[model samples]
Target: MSSSAILDAHQTAQALPYLALTQEIEALLQDPTVAVPPRIVQALHGGGSLFVMPAADARVAITKLISFIPTNAQRGLPTIQGDIVVFDVQTGQRIGLLDGPTVTARRTAAVSLLAAQHLAPRRDGPMLIVGAGVQGRAHLEAFHEGLGVQEFWIASRSASSADALVAHARSLGLQAQRVDDPNAALADCPWVVSATPAQEVVLSAPPHSDAFVAAVGAFTPRMVEWSAPVCQHLARTGTLVVDTRDADHEAGDLLQAGIDVAALPTLADVVGQTARWQNAHRPQGGPVFFKSCGWGGWDLAAARCMAQGIAVSSAPQG
Candidate 1:
């Protein structure tokens, strides 16, 4: 695989540092040249889903093919597995391939971090992460490296997984612990990330007034992590933002709560008009909730970031 054009998970991650990826995502969100259509989702027989996501900018085009299998966790296999095929927009040539799961995890977390950068009430705090899966760990790392978070609290359905994530955080020289109940921990942790496969409400407690919550667990209309009360409270007293317009229908937490997502702002909207939005929301001094349901544009940012990284690494040293 060393000489292959397709980079493995580790290699793909190496090419996409959180800072670079975050900047790329922010830039692409505002670029009018980029075109990203809604992803194509096909239902699988075994309660799984196959997603075909495609996006293109002036320079390159990419398509990600991945499967989400909830049952894979039982078999000790990854829930997401596939590859992102990058092509040259000019020549229609296949340029490279990247591990899909890595792109999803890192890009999703990076998007959260980008939102937090603009919306979070405070930069450094005890961040509470719900769920101990891949997205959970990615959020922990993203907040730590991207925001200088020094403390963490993790809660999950599986205590062992939660403990493992806590240990990983500890290894990174951060204060971390596993909490039996996530709702109770929400009071002290001003920053919260819920990343579970939300068959049931995992976080119903209301966030603190100045808190920032990124709900990334539930993507479908049926899947949800936050309770109705939590979603409604955030909508009424705080600010509600979505990663993309597709979240209006696909974000389970918001949709199930009957949130008027069309009235909500998006990450692109905020990033495009940062100063005006900051001025408007700063006076309110309410919590910020960001709902993300995945988007093809994010995958496109990852592909562009990887291509730039490859070019930089292969350049001659002066």
Candidate 2:
């Protein structure tokens, strides 16, 4: 028999192609008959977060519980940690445990890529990153691999972090550099992704002509990664896309801006209304805002991808 082992970060990273995952996500959502929506439970504090998300279909079920400790980075520990449990739908028996961070990173980036690409008029441009933390690195790799972005510009509050991210990108044979001026840098790139945990604005300038932005930062209502003015501009001038209707409860930037959640289109709306958007295309030189708070279905999708054709053990009981 083949060996059964827990999938760690390394193995999880290569378990699936993000492009395939994004494509599969579209295919799954486009089916009008599928009705299993992801269920999520969240607990949030000033510096800590815990989230439980479960998603399933007719054949499989997966649940992932993710946590965050902000001070872990100060102690030379990773800030985010989680575990995913998989089960067989037929028997309800435990089947797999996969690393949560890897799955989260992959699925988050794939979702961001999906929204950004869907909103963008054209996908060919230097991918710009507004933060150089772990999320930034994940998106860098995701956009490069999934969307064929060959050039990168990373701007961060911490110069060292930006340099480190740039080094990692260069190591992968990608042309990358640190942005000294975020405003000027933002004005020149098309796809800008904000992956920070900042309570303030990251982009000091409006996006370049015909640019698209994927905002993945700020979860709580107190945290505002995109400034109020920028958000107002986005609401006024651009189309806003969110991952789910949960934006009303979780997305701080959208909440702080007083945006009408009903007016904001979710990912499903984007797919379902693609033709209408194209037919009613306004002037082509506006910023596109895609805000994401993540979803449980993505974690399930990642788990299935990693568990494909593999054997995994049951959960250890005390």
Candidate 3:
């Protein structure tokens, strides 16, 4: 019998330098067959946080646990920290253990970029990003390195954080600026990303006519990032693509915004083939929103691709 290979966080980190984890994740997003079942999530009260665990595919199952703690500022540690366990589906054996927070940040940004690649307008334009935390920085890196963004507008409640993000983007050889107002930033950029965990509606007003919005925060029932008006605008004009409609209904952003749950289309509908649901339904103008509630299949696919790459790179030359 052959022994299974085991990988720890260090190995996973080393493998990232050689593998295109971002690109692999993007490919999986385009493939409809990948099975990303509903995620398993739990709320922890002491820290006022929630834990989300998602797993997918038996061939290479990857499980990630994400924590959201708003009060972590009182403590020295970060509010969000977790780990990912990669297993071989056929034999039910563990293969890799990854730094959960790092992978989550990378995968989340990659998924957003994939959505932009498919939904955003053809021409490149200024990009506006709300929130300047880990997700915000990851978005900047991914957009700068992968999306070829020309100019960036970074905004946060904290001006210093926003300025820091802008400077980091410049270090990466990209043109960036800091914005004090969310609405002003939205008005300037055609491509917008909201990565905040604000409980109340942040952008109460509707987006510009040509803007494409990607809402990556607010995964739980209590948290909301986008305002009701924005969701309604999306319903009126473009397609509201989501990882799952069930998850969206539970989100406070959509519920508080009073978005008609019945009107929004599921990822299944967009990826599925049927009458009256052709690809033409994809919005051409106005605000098109793609909300991800997190999927296990995406993680599994990414882990499998990474593992395969590692194996190939380790093989001896002929």
Candidate 4:
């Protein structure tokens, strides 16, 4: 229809342009009353996966379809390629379409940092990041701008990728450097983000007890970014917050660690079922970690925000 809108990658990215947008998304996600339920997630037989997610409330409704192809990176394309379709709640009409990967990259990092706000202590220390890719840069911006990280240390298997990220960070006015020893870097940094797509272990050691680790990659049962020891450490010392309850089944980090995922809590539990999820913690205050395999609710929220931005911008100017 003439009234409908289509948003490209730049416009979609502009929707989540700041930390404040992410803060709103976090609040929405943590609210158990939001009722953004599970969607269809199944692995692809040909080395990828398909995700169909529907997120809605009284005001707006939308669905996102994402396909993950890890090899896309070598093809000079984004690993996540998809689209989000918006629908009018009152009329059930298709209203808008947006670039899915942009919404995802922006929101994923924001969501991870949102968990950090509740699970870890605030500090101005340096932040260490693994995998200097899309998620890595997004996390770096969130930490330096939102979390007040003083410096940044990047580690990656690709020297050029890591160097490029460091330069990008520095250009953003953040103090960034490449590190060879991630273990040592993690020890000094209070905030750590592992954003790689590695199938095997990437972090050899966990940061200190006060450190906040955001395991941002490895969505499949085969791809695990956190090591067994690192996961076990998270299981023993503190509560492991997840993006959704589905992590009980989808998180490779927990499965690799052999941790009983049934005992863990989703970020939604912060609002809905805190008695069991929060009260169980013994207050040892050891290093807390949040593993985000990601979920459709997140995609829905982000896409909705972008759609709203488009609506507001298209309104007749005064």
The most accurate candidate by TM-score is 1
Question: On residues 238-299, what C-alpha lDDT tens digit does candidate 4 reach at each position?
Answer: 66777787787778887778987767777766545577666755576777788788777777
Q: TM per model?
A: 0.96, 0.88, 0.86, 0.92
**Residue 282 alpha-carbon offset, candidate 4, angstroms:** 3.9
Q: Of 2 and 4, which scores higher on TM-score?
A: 4
In model 4, the worst 10-residue window by lDDT is 26-35
- In candidate 3, what are the lDDT values of residues 1-318, reduced to their tens digit? 034444454565455531266567655645654565566566576746555555655356667776767767447566577777777677777766677666666677776776676667643787888988878887777776667887889888878889999999888788999987888667667788888756566776566676767787777666788877777677777666665565555656776667665455554455453343464365356666777755665566557666776578678999
lDDT of 4: 0.78
What overall lDDT, based on C-alpha atoms, would model 1 receive against the true structure?
0.90
Q: Report the lDDT of model 1 for residue 151.
A: 94
Best first by TM-score, ranked = 1, 4, 2, 3
* Reference-based TM-score, model 2: 0.88
List the global CA lDDT of all models: 0.90, 0.76, 0.68, 0.78
How well does candidate 4 match the true structure, expressed as C-alpha RMSD? 2.2
Q: Which tens-of-lDDT digit does each residue in 227-291 have in candidate 1? A: 99889988788888899989888988888888887767789889888653554364567888989
Which candidate's lDDT is highest?
A: 1
Instruction: Report how far off residue 303 is in candidate 1 (Å).
Output: 0.3
